[model samples]
Target: MPLWFDSHCHFDFAEFDQNRQSEWQFARRVGVSGLLIPGVTHARNLQLEALCQQYSWSFALGLHPYFLAEHEQMHFEWLDVALESSLACAVGECGLDRVLAVDDAHWQQQLACFSTHIQLAKRHKLPLILHIRGCHDEAAAMLRRARFEYGGVVHAFSGSEQQGKAWLDLGFCLGIGGAMSHPGAQKLRRTIAALPKTAWLLETDAPDMKPAFWRGPANSPAAIPLLAAMLAQLQGAELNELSAQLERNRQSVLPASYLIREEPSIN
Candidate 1:
């Protein structure tokens, strides 16, 4: 079976609270050898850390934009401390979100928070795991100004081809997920198909973006192969070949120390 690295997932979410262990085992049995869990808030860092340690999974720490109201200036300080001390693989799950109609003050706050995350990622020499939605241009502009040295992925990226290329030029990879399997997502599919092979990373963004067949069901890392198959069909490559190439792409962008190596096969 082909091995997979789910570059982005929220295994820490409450949806998996009851069956996390079984979920992990099922994912591993189905060829998902690695998983990256990203923190959404300061309060969740310790929990995320404990999960990563328990499962040997990698993770990123940041303040998500959707929860901006719940965050404060002190949370930024807390994030900095977390990045400095924890074994986090990156600094994010942070970025802009225009979907929410907020006043200028809130928007500016989001921008400032995102900028701080970029600085933290740079200082720690780790990549970023951005969560951008309808603010690709704004996020791109911020990234260009920061000129972050370490690369990262735009998790669950759904943007124009130009936007995707802009991120790639900024040394970022596009996280492809269950959305690619949706027949109505023609534009996203076309954009991904046109992008270079090295520009893509596989992610389930589980318990959220479940595949078309499993719509309304909680997504899991075990569904990675299903997403992979759809992506392979789009890319016109064999499933195993696409899986291997995506793993290489993931390694190139993410922090090497945080990556969990697969155990040796028994005779």
Candidate 2:
């Protein structure tokens, strides 16, 4: 199997609680050498930290827009502590969303929380793991206004080619997940094809965004290779070639220590 890494996975989610160990082993066996688990709620930091540390996996600490209501005013201080410590390698699963933002007040709250995550990422000198939805323009504007220098991955990117380029211009990458495998994702596939392949990351976003080819009870981190295969076909490149480029793309934004194990030999 070609080497692979899942740049954004929620392996800590309850979906795999019963078989986390077995599931992870299966992932590794399938060539998924690493997974970057991002925090979605403050209450799960330590739990996420412990899980990642236990398996020597990489993780990040941040408040996701989906769970903003659960985030307390004081969690930012706690988040700072984790970021300053050795607990995290990145600073988010943070960004704006249109579907969740029911009103101006909710949108403002997402903006505020996303801004805080951005500032935290800047302060710690870590890349972000953004989660932008329909508000790509707004999110890109915020990142530009914040002068976010450290580039990161934008989870589940559904933007047009222009929007993808905008994020790329800011040193950010678009995470390609199971969604890219859907028959109806022609636009997303086209956008990926148009953008430089170097500006993408492979991820499962497991327990969610299950690929069309997947018929399992839930998505698994192992879906990375499937994603790689799809991307390979999209780019009309060999799997090994795509794998090597994916590794390089991820490493450009994240440090080596974040993903464990030696990378697959690239030739």
Candidate 3:
């Protein structure tokens, strides 16, 4: 079987609190060799770090825009300190979201938080684990203006062809998850299929973004193989090849000490 890496999964969430180890072990046994657990809030970093150490998975750190209202100016300061000392693989799952229910003030806070993460990423020489939605063009423009160079994953990306190209130009890999497997995401699927293999990575975004195969109550890392098979089918390539490229993409963007890097078997 092909080795796989879940480039994004919130394995630290409470949904897995009942049996995180067993679920993770199952995923590994089925060829999900590793996963990247992204940070959404400062309070969860310690718990996430402990889990990553125990399970030998990679992780990132940042405040998510989805919860911008809960964030304070001091959170950014705390993040800066943490990023300086923590062994985080990247600096974000943070970015702009035009579809938020927040008012203008919260939106501005989102922009500020994203900018801080960008600055932190640059300062630490770490890439970003982004969470952009409905504001790809604006975010891309901001990144350009900031001269951000370190690359990372664009989680659950569903942008237009031009927008996808913009993120690619900035050296980021677009994360392909259960959403991409949906038949209705015609434009997203078509745009992704056209991009080079290096531009894509696999994720389940668990305890969320359940694949089209089943509308399960919650997603999990174990769903990776299913998503991988779907991605290979969409890309019109062999499963083994897709597996190899996805691994390569992850290592390229988010290198962490815990991850045991192995050479890709694809030619």
Candidate 4:
């Protein structure tokens, strides 16, 4: 069986609280050797750290834009505390998202938060775990300005070919998840298929973007192989080759401490 990595997810969420261990067991059975869990909020940050400690998997911590309203200015203090204690693999789940709205005031706050995380990643010489939706251009521009020394993966990326290329130019890997497995996601599937193996990493974004087969049910890491098989078919590569490339892509963008580095057996 091919070893696989889930480059992004939220295993600390309530969806996994009930049967988290069982979920992990199924994921291992289905070839998911490891997962990268990115933090979304204050509550989830600590929870994610604990989860990582328990599973010995990798994780990242940051404030998500969707919950921007709930954050206080002083939250940065807590953020610092969390980062200090965290054995996280990276420094985000943080970035701009113009999908809903972002007035100048909130936008500036978001930038400050993002900048802090970028600095943290640099200080630790770790990769970043990002989330940029509907703000690719702005995010890219800002990233250019930030000029992160250690690049990372852009979680659940669904941008244009141009945007994808632009991010690739910056040395970031595009994360492809269950979202790309939907039959109706023609553009995403096509884009992912055409992307160079070096530019792609597999993720599930579990409990959120469930694959088509598990539409009504909660998404789990167990769905990784299902997504990977579809991706390999689309990319026109052998399953083992795709899996190896995916693992390589992940290790290249994420911190080495995230997983046990092992040689890819191409047999």
**Candidate number achieving the greatest TM-score relative to the actual structure:** 2
lDDT for residue 147 in candidate 3, whole number 0-100: 95
Task: Name the TM-score of candidate 1.
Answer: 0.94
| Candidate number with the higher lDDT (1 or 2) | 2
Q: Write the per-residue lDDT of candidate 4 for residues 14-133, one digit (tens) a residue.
A: 887889888887777767888988878777775776668788788887778777777666666676666666677777788877664548787787777778778777777777788888
**Candidates in order: C-alpha RMSD to true structure:** 2.2, 3.0, 3.7, 3.6
Report the C-alpha lDDT of model 3 over 1-267, residue by residue, as the tens digit. 888888888988899889787777677667788888888877876567777877778889888988777777787888788888877889878998988936788788788889988999999899998998888988889999999999888999888878888899999999988888777988878887888888898889999998888555789888989888878887898999888787778778876623434532232
Off by over 4 Å in 3: 257-267
Q: Order the candidates by lDDT, highest first — what do you get?
A: 2, 1, 3, 4
lDDT of 1 at 186: 91
How good is model 2 by TM-score? Answer: 0.95
State, as a TM-score between 0 and 1, how close model 3 is to the true structure: 0.93
lDDT of 1: 0.85
For 1-267, candidate 1 gives per-residue lDDT tens digits of 888889889999999899888888888877888889988877887688887888889899988998888888888888888888888888889888887638889888888888999999998898999999988998988878887778799999999999999999988999998888887999999998899888998888988998888753599988888888888988899988897788788778985524445752332
lDDT of each: 0.85, 0.86, 0.83, 0.80
* Cα TM-score per model: 0.94, 0.95, 0.93, 0.91
Worst 10 residues of 2 by lDDT: 258-267
Q: Which residue ranges in model 1 land beyond 4 Å of their true spot?
A: 257-267
